[model samples]
Target: MDFYLTALLQGLCFAGIAFGIYISMKIFNIPDITTDGSYTLGGVVSGAMLTHNLSGYLILPAVLLAGALAGALTGIIHTKLKINALLAGILVMTALYSVNLTILGRSNLPLLNMPNLFTLITFTTNINQNSLIILTGFVLVFTLLIGYLLKTDFGIAMRATGNSEPMIRALGVNTDRMKITGLALANALTALSGYLIVQLQGFADISMGIGIVIVGLGSVIIAETIINWLRITSVWWSLVLVMAGAVIFQFVLAFTLNIGIDANLLKLVTAVFVLLIVGLPRLTGRQA
Candidate 1:
């Protein structure tokens, strides 16, 4: 039970990334590869701040701003410079590797014996319960805030830009700005996940975020599948479902690990699982 509970907490930590993936991929229709690098950037930034005895609350704004800056850089390169969106994300992601290392001044940073957010915000004496409560709160607040944003006029315009750029431009909406803002918002959420998880796991590694977008994408894909099956249309519910999807993905992975799957094989499992999730719908549509 404790193992599964830890997995649930892990899922909650990942809800931010899921939100990011939803904004960039599902909403903006862009493959933002910056997720991998920006995630580590968040961790490194958080880790560095933690070392300085800075309050966890104080460090978050900086982490978020850093992530937003990374995302906006990609957006600028893609929109202003006319580079492919995919390539722009790749470039920023690649550049962030060295930046993260430089910030940490090393390859890894340990938060052992350091005052971190999870402990600072806890309401209970039990470590597990504290983690669960804090992570749950973070995920809930973030999901609601993002869901509300998506339903607003500006957010609707961003969605429209993705759905039909030419149509939105004809309506006098600046599609480029929409894309840039959307990407910035997405990466900010991604950074929040890193900020939270570094404290949760007690260490931040330079390579921790390698291919993390897959985890976020898997959660989004899973939520999308369930939403389509249930025909759910409420924006809030869709966001909630995405959070549920994150939990489910983590639960499944935990089950796999518990069943004796080698840790190194987990990546392969993730790939195959995401592929199946992506492919099954196509197969069903073809049959229909």
Candidate 2:
């Protein structure tokens, strides 16, 4: 029970990344691999600031800005330089490794002694419960905000740019600018996930973002599966399901570990699990 509770908390912490992936992949139809770098960049920025006793208010914006800038750089490469979107993301992600290491000035930074968002306020004496409360609130606010954004005029244009770039462009929409803005928004949320997770886990490492994009991808895939099955059309419900998908993904991992899978093999297990999530539906659909 305790183990699963921790996983649940982790899922909440991951809501940001899930939302980010939904925006990038589902809305813009881009597999922005910059997620891997931006996530760690968020942790690096937050961890660096917290160690210096910075407030969460300051750290949060800094994390978002850093991630957005990284994403925007990728967008510029793809749109302005006419580079392939995937390759542009790969370039930025690769560059961020050295950039993150330079910023941290070390491979790992311990943040246990730092004043984190969870420690700033006390909802109850139980630390885990307090963390759960804060994380839930954080996820709720972002879900509502993103949901609202997706329903707005600009947001519709962004989605239109994704659904039919030529059509949107013909309608006087600046497709290039929309792609840039959308990617920036996606990576900003990804960074927010990093910021929250570092504070939760009590440390930050240069390698923390390695393969992290898969977690978000998996969550989005799970949400996509359900959305298709239910034919969910409401933006708010779709976002809610994405958040739930994040939690469900975590639970599945927790169950796998509980069944005594070796920690070393967890990544392999994760890959296989995601494959099942993605493939099973198609297999069933074919038979049906």
Candidate 3:
């Protein structure tokens, strides 16, 4: 039971990345691989600051800034430099590996005795319950915020840029700027996931972000499947489904481990699971 509960908390910690992927891939139609780098960048930033005795709350804005800058760099490389968007994101992600290493000045940084967000406030004597409450609150706040943003005029414009770039451009909208801002916002949220996860895990590793984008992609894909099935049209509900998808994704992985899958094969299992989730719909459509 405790193991499953921990997975639930981890899913909540990953909600931010799910939201980021939803915005970048679903809304902007950009496969921003910068998420891999920015996520670790967030963890390293948080880890570095906490080691200096900084308040967890105060470190968040820095994490956001770092992630946003990384995203904006990818956007600029893609839009202004005429590079492929995918390649641009890859370049930024690769470069971020060095940047993250430099920031942490080591391969791994532990925060066992350091102050963190979880320690800042106590809701229950049980640490896991306290984490559950705080993580749930964070997820709720982000869901509401993203939902409201998507309903606004600016959000519509951002969506339009992705839906039809030429059309939005003809409408006097700067498509490049929109892409940059959208990617920036997406990576900022991704970084927030790192911020939360590092505190939960009590350490930051240089390799932590390796292949992490798959987690967010898996969650978004799950939500997309539900959206297609329900034909969901509401922004709020879509965001909520995305959050639910994150939780469900984690639970599925937890179940796999509980059923005796080798821990070393977990990544392979994750890949196959996501492939099924993504490919099954298409297979069914063909059969129909």
lDDT of each: 0.91, 0.92, 0.93
Local accuracy of candidate 2 as per-residue lDDT tens digits, 12-107: 988889999999899999989999999999999999999888887899999999999999999999999999999999999999999999988899
lDDT for each residue of candidate 1 in 1-288, tens digit (9 for 90 to 100): 989999999899999899999999988999999999999998999999999998766899999999999999999999999999999999999999999999999988999789988777759999989999888877888887888888999989999999899999999999999999999999999998899889989998999999899889899999998888778889899999999888889998998899999999987887788788768877888321
State the displacement of the C-alpha of residue 9, model 2, in Å, after optimal TM-score superposition: 1.2
lDDT of 2 at 44: 95
Question: Which candidate model has the greater TM-score, 1 or 2?
Answer: 2
Q: Report model 2's TM-score to 2 decimal places.
A: 0.96
Q: Tell me the TM-score of each prediction against the true structure.
A: 0.96, 0.96, 0.97
lDDT for predicted candidate 1 compared with the true structure: 0.91
| Residue 52, candidate 2: C-alpha displacement in angstroms | 1.2
Output the TM-score of candidate 3: 0.97
State the lDDT of candidate 3 residue by residue for 152-175, as single tens digits. Answer: 999999999989999999999999
Residue 175, model 2: lDDT of 92
